[model samples]
Target: MRKLLSILMILLSIQAFAQDDKSKDRIDYSGEYNGTFTDIKDAEGTMQLFLYQPDKGRTSGIILLTRIVNGKSEVTTGTINIEGNGEFISGNFMPSEIKYIAPREDEDGIMQNTYDSYSCRWEIFGQITDKKGNTIIGKAVPANCVESNLIEFRINKKK
Candidate 1:
């Protein structure tokens, strides 16, 4: 019985050490990341983010989400906030504007209509993934719950 108890105690200590090590393996989420997303079948969208350290334990940045709708590209800007204690790899994408760009003409005789482009208010939560921490995956839900389909995105950092 004593020998079994000793083995169990050793295993518990190892498990605690592993938890500490895993917490220490936090990724530094800085620099720029770009990737694509899909909300539905064949729906293509792009995402770009630039993260920087504003202060100690505070990371902020600007992200752009460009989605194609009816053959025209629409842009939505969001403010990124990674406000946590030591874990700065997970955060959110808060919509800055429903539509960063209004539908207009391109100087020539072409009408680029992106009406209601600013109507996308998705609550997106992103988390860093991969062993090397070079990738980020996120899921979003429309603010008004209009989009029942899953809105998933994945971004990667450049080497």
Candidate 2:
């Protein structure tokens, strides 16, 4: 009877540990994010972000361009998937390509127009948070880069 009781206690401990582990892998992101695109050549814009955390370890949102060249505004939707346990987050933008006119000087000394596509990718590294102001003990380094361009942004989450 004592041996059986000991085995039962061990099982209970194992179950509790498993639950804790699962909880630690959860992430919560619910807030408005304002991002500035630095290191961009010949581009001026401020990106307004709205993020919704439908569940742990997952986030989705839309990014709007409040300012850009030619007085044009654009919006794009994207998803963020985070692995809390690994402290890594990666996501891709839908319609992943944006076209814009490249600024150039022509023989006439006037700005000539050339179309170019910019590809975007978001990568984040930091600690995941929960609703009750509790953080899942981890780290995240979030970065966004445009392909084929020298533009890249690396932002650390503000405490």
Candidate 3:
């Protein structure tokens, strides 16, 4: 009877330890977020973010942009940083430096779409309120070359 009690006690303790370790594991931030930059003119789009654990003890993700450029699809994808316990999360996605299109008035004073290139990017860093919550990133540059550091976008995890 004493031996049986000792084994049961050890099993219980091990179970408790396992639960404790699971709680300390990183909170899952993988999901799709829809948002719009409130501070930029004519800025409206959807941001799909996919996060995964690249290896032991680290995290990374990709940011997919749609309709942020003149109705053309552009994307920014890369790593982002999340603060302790997922209370705060932060990351930046820079679109590859490549030649894209630009629209402007030609010498004839008529609107036209021309090809040009610039370093376009969008960054997200803010508090998550909770494991499943809303967040506001302070700055987001649209797919175009127009740089606006004062731009801010409110993101909500889709239900």
Candidate 4:
């Protein structure tokens, strides 16, 4: 009976160590990430992102700038909280809102000016790819606004 008890204790110790190591292997996504928005028309720009873990199952980041379309840009200098569930990523933003709506063509063959507020729920469906081509698929939901005036882009972490 003593030998059997000893074996059980050894198994429990091994399990505990395994759990500790697994937690230590958690990925650290806290850094400046450069990526492009890939799902928009005439969208060509890079975004600087700062990511951090505020608590368990919660990650937050901020976009320094979102340059989309020529001569048009939006600055999100405020903090945006993002949460992760499994392979999904989502968040929201406020205090930094700008809109660029499409101009309407008038009879004079000129575009009419129309100003609107920017409110969009930015959604990205892609993966974080490494230099070796390995990808970590995920999604991001921004809480800045409900409807965007311009097209959105999918971002892949830049190398």
Candidate 5:
């Protein structure tokens, strides 16, 4: 009887641990979010965001800009620092840098260093209120470039 009871307890413990592991994936801020930036002149069109939880109070996601200011598809990777669990979340999109070879005329008026490189980059910011349930509504702000503007967005947990 003692051996049987011990075996049962061990099985139950294993089951409980497994359940706990699954909860890690059900984070409050993990989901697919869809919304638009409020400022239409600077940035028009819609944006989609996919956010996932790496650990508690942290989130990682991708931001997709469609038909915005530049009339081109833009994708950005971002991280958010969540405080008060799901009360507040804010982060900036890591700037995407492009390096390309450019040919420029030297002082002697001769094209030289055709392999010379140049880079351009832009960044965006997100500040939102976490509903603590399944929705996060926030604003997307552009920075580090020409214009600084605000865009509103709301993201919900994916079913």
Candidate 6:
């Protein structure tokens, strides 16, 4: 009975240490990331993202994108919050809310078709890669806009 009890205690101790080490092995994903997306027309756009994780399971960031519309360039910026699971090596991303920044008139008056208010709800689904610089591959869409096309994007972390 004494030997059996000792073995059980040793097993428990090993389990506890394993759990502790697992947490420490989680990847840190706080940095600037740049990505590109191809629209339905096959035109490519650029994405600049600043991401940080405040706590386990919660990742938040500011994102900016520039795309061509009707031969003109349009820029949009927003805030994104998502629930994260998996290490920085690879994982799932669940968006909580993605809201565009309040709009403003074209200050220079050189831009066309600009709006005073830009509203959008974005949904992004994808995974983080384990490759060099940890590339990100995903699909992004304007979830509330029916006319918007889905964009497939790949991003890499900046050094």
Cα-lDDT of candidate 1: 0.69
* Predicted structure with the largest lDDT when compared to the true one: 1
Runs off by more than 4 Å, candidate 5: 1-27, 40-42, 68-84, 95-131
The lDDT, on a scale of 0 to 1, for candidate 4 is 0.53
TM-score ranking, high to low: 6, 1, 4, 3, 5, 2
Q: The CA-based lDDT of model 5 is what?
A: 0.55
Q: Write the per-residue lDDT of candidate 2 for residues 11-39, one digit (tens) a residue.
A: 99999999989877664555565545533
* lDDT at position 148, candidate 6: 65
Worst 10-residue lDDT window, candidate 4: 131-140
Per-residue lDDT for 150 in model 1? 54
lDDT of 2 at 38: 34
Q: What would the TM-scores of all predictions be?
A: 0.59, 0.50, 0.53, 0.54, 0.50, 0.65
| TM-score of candidate 5 on Cα atoms, chains taken together | 0.50
Q: Give all candidates' CA lDDT scores.
A: 0.69, 0.48, 0.56, 0.53, 0.55, 0.67
Candidate 3: give its CA RMSD in angstroms.
7.3
Candidate 5 C-alpha lDDT tens digits along 1-159: 999999999999999999889766444666777766445355455666687766554666666555433566544333433333445555666434443457679899987543211122323333444435566666645544333456566656556
Candidate 1 vs. true structure, TM-score: 0.59
Candidate 3: residue pairs that collide: none
Clashes of 5: 4
lDDT for residue 116 in candidate 4, whole number 0-100: 28
Question: Considering only N, C-alpha and C atoms within 3 Å, which residue pairs clash in candidate 4?
Answer: 38-154, 90-141, 92-143, 93-143, 119-145, 119-146, 120-145
Per-residue lDDT tens digits for candidate 6, residues 79-153, read: 776555552332223233334344455758553432222235667776777733267787766654524666688
What clash count does candidate 4 reach? Answer: 7
Candidate 1 local lDDT, residue 112: 69
Cα shift from native, residue 32, model 5 (Å): 1.8
What TM-score would candidate 4 get against the native? Answer: 0.54
Order of candidates by lDDT, top first? 1, 6, 3, 5, 4, 2
Clashing pairs in 5: 33-155, 37-151, 37-152, 38-152
